[model samples]
Target: MFAVTILGNNSAIPTLDRHPTAQVVTCNEQLLLVDCGEGTQLQITQYRIRRSKLRYIFISHLHGDHYFGLIGLINTLNLMGRTEPLSVYAPPELEQIIQLQLDCSGTILKFELSFVPLLPGYSGLILEDKDLRVSCFPTQHRISCFGFSIEMQKRKRKLIPEQAKAYEIPAAYFSKLQEGADYQRKDGSIIKNDWVTLSPGKAKRYVYCADTIYDVNLLPWLKDADMMYHETTYLHDLEDRAAERYHSTTVQAASLAAAAGVKKLLIGHFSSKYTELQPFLDESRPVFANTDIAEEGVSYIV
Candidate 1:
């Protein structure tokens, strides 16, 4: 279940066929909402996502297209009697904006809602848990924006069942062996854990580059990522406009993915002007062979 589901991928404007920026990062049984643009709640229901499984919300910035639906989503959770606590990570100003809306409406949420403010120009590890590790880094954009790198932790070691059986290990001790625990035989001989288990493979990483301008500073974070989502607000021909608006064009996003040597590239956050999306992949695949358009409602496994 480790994957990213695209909910909305358009830019500032919300067209009939496309909404704003929103996505769901699924890590095993946990669901993390990456952004909450307009109609995010509707999109969630449309995609049949279990609302109760959503535990964390991460807002890239305070832009309306990025977080305008936060209040509504939060309210809906309360209305649905969600007693479990929810955590939101976003730019510092977002807390105030959300609070004002809640205060004016005199709505006290039924669930405990907590907010973790991300400072402007901040970069470093922000969250670490049993199954996931998340870090934030700055991106060149019109406003203070941040990109997130999500790594799905592989805690279990690779177990060699044949090797374990040859060593006369009991089936009941297999789980402990996979957890790197050594086995002691009846004769009091200790079988080293490494004799039957190997270190887990590299963790799978997903990098979400929120709205950003063309900048190579992000490579350090994006390098060798399993999958990366970069904004492509315009076609290559509109490079000038993209730079001026502090957004990225198709070529820019693809080139970065190529330079970073990421396994797969997902280009989205399209400008409202472009109704045709195939051209994005058409243009990107030339630079990065494994590029795909981040279509809404599709889930990209990490």
Candidate 2:
């Protein structure tokens, strides 16, 4: 059940048909909100996301399009009487920004809100829970920004029922076997766990290359990811403009995805000027066949 749902795919400005940059990553029962741009609360309601299960929020940068809706969403959650603690990870300045807004408005949240500051150029493991492990790396953006690498961990070994039955192992001990523990027979004979259970499958990863210009240094973080989300703010023809704005064009995004060997590529954060999205696909698919538009309200499984 590891998946990411696009909330607002547009960049900078909200269009009639598109909003700003926001996404929700579902890791088992928990939800991680990434980049709560303006109108994000409404988007969450529209998509019917379980707000109760949202435990973490990751903001890639301080751009208004990336985090302007944070205060509003926090207020909404407090008004809704949410009691669970919510952790937010972002740049150091964001803590003061959010605190100032809360203080001036005399708003007190009912839930415990904690902030973890991501220092400039810091890159390493940021979070690890039972279901997911998240790391962050610096991206080449206008301001200090970061990209998230999320890995879904498979902790339990796969049990071979036939092999277990052949070993005369009781079903009561199957759970233990799946936990990689040896089983002892009534005669005190040890049955190796590997004899009846296979190792857990490789972890699946989703890398979010948040708001970066085309930079190959990200290859180490993006390599071999199961799914990667990279912003294609403009068509290939706007490559120069994209460079000027510290953004990426469709061809550049596709080329990086191809070079990194990601299983699939989700491209979004479109410029408000683009009305028809087909040109983006038309320009990207030839360069990388596995690219898909990160359409709002659509869930992409990793």
Candidate 3:
């Protein structure tokens, strides 16, 4: 159930078919929105996403394309009678921005909202929940920016049914076995937990490189990800311009993904200059196979 749905993928502006940067990361039943670009609320509605289950949000930067829709989403949540608490992770200055917007509009939310600042000169694990763990790292962008790594932890241990049955363990106790509990017979004999259970399998990870210039320093964060989303704001031909503007090109993004040995790559945040995007694929697939365009409505399973 861990997947990421692309709500908006364009770089600097909205387009007829494309949108600015925003994504919904579904970790089982819980949802962590990565960014809230303009019109993100409508994008959620159009894609049939359940906004009610969103418990946390991570804004990568202060760019309007990254978080301009936060106020609108908060207002709408209040209108919908939401009572659950929501936490937002972003720079320290975002608190003042949100406060100003709410104060100026005389808007009061019906639910609790908290902010966790992603400060400069610091980067490490930021969140650990029942289903997922998230870490943040600084990225080289025009403004202060951070990238997120969402890893889905395996919950249940593998059950060896034959081993359990040989130990006379009852079927009703299997759930307990999966929870790493040993069995005890009526005769007061103990059946060891390891006799019937194995460790949970590997955890799957999804990394989002919000916006950045071409830099090899990101390899550590991108390493061994089950899937990764890196912005390809331009085609390979615009390499010079991309470097000057602090955006990445398709070839640069693909090279990093390939070097990191990620399982799959989802590239988006296309510059509005190019109306056609097929060239991005044509250029990136040479460097990394399994490269995909982050289309607005498609969900890429991590």
Candidate 4:
């Protein structure tokens, strides 16, 4: 169930067929909304995503295309009688912005809303829930933007039923054994936990490089990631424009993914000018064979 579903993939200006940046990261039953761009609420409904499952949101920057839908979505949630608390992680200024809107409209949310401010030039682990860990890092965007790294931890060890049965351990204790607990027989003998269970597998890592220019300093965060999402706002020929705008080109995104040795790469945040997206893949796959265009409404397994 660990996967990311793209809601909007287009950059700045959204069109009828494409939209601004927004995604839903599904970690089992929980959903983390990353970058709620314009039209995000509609996209969520159109994609049949469970809005009730949404627990937290991470906004990369204060750009209109990145978070213009926040106020609308929050208001809609209240109107729909949502009572569950929700947390939003974003730039410090967003807190004031959201509060002002709420005040002007005399809106009192039915749910508990809290905001966690992400300071500029900050990079560290920001969240840890049951089996999910999220960290943030700065990206070289026009404004103080950040990227997110999500790691899904394997909490339970692989249980060996045959080994447990051979030791005459009851099936009722299998849950505890998987949690790395030892079994004690009625005769007062103890069976080691390691004898019947194997260590958990490596954690699955997913890095979202929100928006950035071609920067090699990000290699450390992207290194060996199971999957990564990097914005390719332009084609290779427009590398100059991309640099001027502090955005990334298709070739640049793929090059970084290749250098970082990530298992897979998802490229999105395409500029409105580029109606055709296949060329992006053509430019990226040569550098990283696992590169994929982040298509709206498609879920990529992490």
Best by lDDT: 2
Rate residue 218 of model 2 by lDDT. 98
CA-lDDT, candidates in order: 0.93, 0.96, 0.93, 0.95
* Model 1, span 191-210: residue lDDT tens: 99999999989999999999
State every prediction's TM-score relative to the real structure: 0.98, 0.98, 0.97, 0.98
Q: Residue by residue across 47-66, what tens digits does model 4's lDDT show? A: 99998999999999999999
Error of 4 at 193 (Å): 1.0
Per-prediction RMSD in angstroms? 0.8, 0.9, 1.0, 0.9
Error of 3 at 160 (Å): 2.1
Question: Candidate 3, residue 259: CA error in Å?
Answer: 0.9
**Candidate 1 ranges with C-alpha deviation above 4 Å:** none
**After superposition on all CA atoms, how large is the RMSD of candidate 4?**
0.9
By TM-score, how accurate is candidate 2? 0.98
> Which residue pairs collide in model 3, if any?
none
**Candidate 2: worst 10 consecutive residues by lDDT?**
101-110
User: Which sections of candidate 2 miss by over 4 Å?
Assistant: none
